[model samples]
Target: MSWQTWRTALISAAATALVVGLLTDTGQPTHPTTVAQASPPASGPGTNHAIDDPLTSERTRAWREDRFGMFIHFGVYSHLEGEYTRPDGTVCRDAEWIKRQCRIPQAEYERFAAEFNPAEFDAEAIARTAKEAGQRYIVITSKHHDGYALWPTKVNRWNLRDHSSFDKNRDILAELKAATERHGIKLGFYYSIWDWNDPDAVHPSTFGRYKERMYAQLKELVDNYQPSVFWFDGEWSTDRPSNPWLTQDGEALEAYVRTLDPKIVVNNRVGKRRLVDGDTGTPEQTIPAEPVSGQLWESCMTLNGSWGYAKWDNRWKSPADLTRNLISIAGRGGNYLLNVGPDARGRIPAESVDRLRAMGSWLVRNRQADAVHGAGTPGIVAEPDWGSVSRKGDTLYASVYRWPGAGGSLTLKALSGFDVRSARVLGSTQRVAVSRSGDTVTLTPSGAPTNDIATVIAIGVAPPAPAAIGTGTGLKAEFWANRKPGGTPTVTRTDPLVNYNWKYQGSPDPTILYSGFSGRWTGFVQPRFSERYTLTTLTSNTVRLWVDDKLVVDNWQDHGPLLSSVAVDLQAGKRHKIRLDFRKESNEAVAKLLWSSPNTPEQVIPTTQLYPA
Candidate 1:
């Protein structure tokens, strides 16, 4: 469960995928809302839903709309309360991985199952907590890495039913499922792929048998509970150097799960959770600073530092801090899955409940819960220093974490071009005075902020002008068609953008040489707003870029799919010279130039903004 160790597993898995070439991601719709049946699970030699399937898109979109979810890490490890005294007069304190971290023997670890009785576990209360927290979904540990199952499993006797002191017929998972359904929230299960106590999973000879048992257990969970999400973990090779799990295993398991229920959402950890691995990317314990383009993602972080219950780990995040995180993640087009570890008696820490309730109360009081639901990155405005921005349709919701002085002006510098209709403070009828200057609009609330945590400002606007290609639009592109950059170009023409993917083919011009080509694009780019812009390039082989005659990206050596970015100040109504040079060293050629400013979404420089140089 250490991030460093998980990264090692990811690297190994990525290498395997590259060797096998089993994943190729065709583009998917950025947002789709219709529910359609998934294609029959993929057959030989590729990932499930590698192609754009309507069902996958719909399911992914729906999951993304949930926006926030609860993650419960409860298992037999909670009984230890993060401390284990060894026979050799040594004591170790840890959560979840007590057996491994404390170096307890398998027999000794098994004995703890007898004492794993969560007598106070109230499924209704847990589900209610999620609902009260404004969380739309819940993913609890069905089985942890310790190989302790929360529910009764027929596949093994090491489960709560057969081994634990808890009542044999009491099914926590089933109770949770019913409670979640009653509360109108989705339910999911987290299952660890690694098993410390299962001896069959260690040796090479018995690994396949262990895998079969794992599959059977998964099937049992699916048939009994019908979960909406199957979150997998512990696939990385940490303790076991001879770990037999492979990308191929992940692919097969994913396909099998789809066959059982294609509607289920699976995390990327089912494989490496890298490119084209699973339905969604899982970034643990951290929120990405920028929006993760081309992939649906979620960040899972604990309330404190530990995943399982630790009596001494009382480092709970404040409700205000958690609320801001949720807003920040939503602004960056991702979901927040917050964790809560229940103690030995099946009681959620009072601190966690109090904070969660406070957040739910804030959401309702601000009337911005719907604004966070399915809200995406603000494409029309730059994020402000005082707050974060999320967009739903043409409306922008600004969650101001730092309030300006009471009745002070909240300036949106880049919103001059937008035809803003109205502005107001959410959850209040306080008149907001809107005034405009040359390229900026200011909103001054009549009263102080309604809440101390984050004040929501709602700005309604007319749909902005389309960023259409302008009258004279094109870049002067010169192609060598053969060899690296040198001498006169073999072909020259006006191209719209420095965008091409000659990975499987060669040469944009049929007259040019098919392989080992070089090209340069020169143009003038005009910005729509005066703001700081992030210029980005995704390229293969050697590539470099210059903006306003100043070098920006300089990857002048051979490479594969290298993404480089640089930020620069730009002015509206002014044309800046831009140039990009690339050479196809050998295979997998690609080049793209993209930019995003405060008021613009990241996109290839459009034809309207480019002129032949």
Candidate 2:
């Protein structure tokens, strides 16, 4: 993404860069936590660029449907609850960062390991709560920054079973896995690659020893319990200069894990902010201010002021906020990993349970608004003095966040070209009356909203409006049999834009997925400003983009391409020359052209902005 995209996520930046930095360890808000936004990471996996096979596709597809999940942050920090009082008298507010904030000696901090005893930690109850709250998966911290493991491992003797006095013989992971399996709930583990307690964590020469320990632990966990998702963190201390080879080791571990279990889903934090081949982009405590597109992302956030348990940090987000955030993320085509930090006794807060159940009830009533198995993500529409609107296929859900008045109609400006079929209140059968006037579609519900929290009006849209026949109206793709463009092409076609995934199609448009097939697209792009623009190229095999005879992006590679961008300058209202080329060497094939300008949302260059040149 462009600079604006990263800066717009949330909060003030710290020593270590984060898209969303809610606060420093000092307990002060870095930026507004109400709503945070993040584009994709600087660079990582793009749309469906993974090594595609039957198993990989099946696992990722299932994971996508299981959009909602619960994130558990339980560790020794829960026992402290931010109770560290500094010498200057002020207490360190973030209990989870106690090691860093209190500056405790490593040997002294190791004592907290034995104090870990959570008899109230009922795995079955947690799984049931997630199921009740409409969540399909749960991820808990198997190991955290404190280097204390929640389960027994031969490689790491400083684990719950090895150090804890209460249940030194029991394995927390084994027990949790058993309980979740009983409830038919998917379970995962959060592994911290950075072990501060390890001498190798600081000593570069001994880093190899640390890597061995981490790999052994990871292998043991995976082999023992077939985990679905692996949430990796603490790969590097980006703020400080530690071991330089940590990232390489992280990459090696990811490769090794895939050999163990190809179906296991890994997050983007594996090698310091998605430096390795990972599945999902994990954004911490941030919601997109507006809708997001292109890449798949998940927002991992705490319900309250702190990530881990903080006895005094009870400032929880309201149920309305939580439920809206969930729906909002779903609408934008992402997942919400809502977090809950259990207390020392491993009991989830009753208040948190209440909020989750409330959201679950809402989900039950507005199942259509859940955005599951949807054809399209919600596009921002101008609904003047009205409510927000989200879409799934032909259905448009007008989210009733605020009422215009006691009895008033909603005017959707974006529904100008869309021929609406009918409108109805969610959970009700009666279709409401809809009227139109000069590109303004208005809807009036049969009666007042029954639910105070959020009411949704399901507007049925007719098929898309047909395009007018004319040149310079859309994109044109021409194919050639040879490596370079020569005489007349073998096949030619026009499309609204470039978006192809030959994995499902078996062959690209006007070309085959394998062998030497060259393709070219010629069009005119209308720029909005005389500023630098980012042209992102995502394709299988080799792909290149040229703007006005200048090669803006020459990203040619083998296999599924990572989303890469290049910058160029263009003036407002001016039609600039645009050309894109694609070459398919073997296997899967795809080609997508996306762009973003200063102040404009990143998007595929639409037909309105493209013309035959």
Candidate 3:
């Protein structure tokens, strides 16, 4: 059924239940009907112990209480400002486009290493700003898809040190670690598993060898950094013909990381597909309507349009918007990792700083209402007009998003079952009157709140029960039309091709190519996809997918060089025409397509679903 139809059915079911509840009196006690009474608030020494266990609930509590944090996306790409430059210094169309797009040889692109200097970067300043802005932790990009290591690594010399001119020896990760430690803030790192520069890395055709290399590097990073959290990206490489590596060993990777440090929080990327160990990393600008149960989750978003420093991307969110988002996430028992992109000189944009400062001020006044032990109450519905409500021991904090219309009374159906000792607006100590009836608790304030945004109402209760998990099934994906026509019939050319290059205008745009070839060709595809995908190649040629659309995979990169069938989802009983569009060319060409699914236990094969092309 369609989403709209499902939603209508759900609404109808809820309305029916509400009517039934109102009609049945059945001599049931109006209040305190259950044999159990609310437990008294746990106090003092035991409070810490009660929260010591780092379960999903405890983590959610800690995150909600944090209220504010910082996100940093910095790497060699910062030097290019999202675009690459030619040898003579002409700015390429897609600067941060990746290595292959520049079409420069490996030696030439490596030449950029000499100029990769972030002279003005100050780790201490960044940490101090975050602390002052009321942030409790900081997450930075330790590495990106380009494969340039921000920290010193023994595995490869193509890191910040040997390749870059900027105090190449300095360790950015170590310095940031020390800075955050001194400032009493937790530190996390974003690591990309897919490497564009590493020929041994996973591409479309080579599965076994690539997995070995990928795991080795991950182990090295985890051992060295001991990061509080590991944000993994680039799990999918199936789209590019050059990428021969395709293996779903996420469970194994997660188990390995946990053995190293059980406390280390790993995102959903480490699991099959993008599923990580701890929680799903829902990108910024998107909020799930319902929460995911039996799993830890967080929403990572940017304060502005871009995650990295983009000079022209000035769209910034106000402090109020940021605070509302935080409260919403917390109310739903989730965390928000707000991000910021620093300039090449390593300076946090002034506008971002100002907005953070504003949030810091508001947090100070409302800290108690958001302390670490509080969890939201169950059976309470939040309306956009009314706002969110959270619960502490015996107190319920109702955060009003806007003033009520006409009457200023706040109503809650779950409150009728409990006795309210007192009610008061947060930031003020004055008590307000609260009345409880069969299934309704009404709070009448003496006066209007002074705050323009959200106002919190604290309701004193006897005690609280554990939170109830929301009901929702697993995730699913719906396939639409392909970007390329006739599936870009794979073609094989005997003549040597100088280079296979493709240009991507922006980050995160899906690009696909169709080719019909059968040969063992060897070349390097440089350009890489920002987000990883499962790579599938149709031909016998050792194919590897690289960002900048380079052919990093060849006969050597492919193990067994297995040819697997492809599948695509179409209307159950309908025919549709296929089209292929080749936007750019690459030196290393292989016929392949990238695909991902939101569902598990079911793999969609594109070739199997193919009709006459």
True-vs-predicted CA distance for residue 353, candidate 1, Å? 0.7
What's the lDDT for all of these models?
Answer: 0.75, 0.65, 0.50
Backbone-clash count (model 2): 3
**Looking at candidate 1, what is the lDDT of residue 109?**
61
TM-score of each: 0.73, 0.70, 0.61
**In model 2, where do residues sit more than 4 Å from their true spots?**
1-49, 53-56, 85-91, 236-250, 274-277, 366-376, 379-387, 415-417, 429-431, 436-439, 465-543, 546-613
Clashes of each: 3, 3, 83
Residue-by-residue lDDT tens digits, candidate 1, 1-613: 6445344323332111101101112221111112222232444211113323211256666787889999999998899988888798776777886666566655556567667899889999999999999999999999887777887776656677766778877999999999999999999999988776566666668667677777777887899999999999877764442356766567667767877887888887886665335567888888999787535789998888788998988888889899999999999888999999999999999999999999898878867885688787876666777888898878889898887787577877563357778888998888888887786768788887888989998989775454443565769999886767779988889987665644424365666654578889997888877777888786778988999889888988888666788989887768889999988887556676778765666666777788889
Clashing pairs in 1: 382-598, 469-608, 470-608
lDDT of 2 at 183: 74
Between prediction 1 and prediction 3, which has the larger lDDT? Answer: 1
Candidate 2: tens digits of C-alpha lDDT, residues 168-279 = 6667778888888877778998887655555565557865666666666777789898899998877545422253445445445656667668888887667556412366
- Ten-residue stretch with the least lDDT total in model 2: 32-41
TM-score of 1: 0.73
Report the error of model 1 at residue 78, Å: 0.7
Deviating ranges (above 4 Å) for candidate 3? 1-68, 83-109, 204-210, 240-247, 273-284, 368-384, 405-407, 429-431, 463-613
Better of 2 and 3 by lDDT: 2
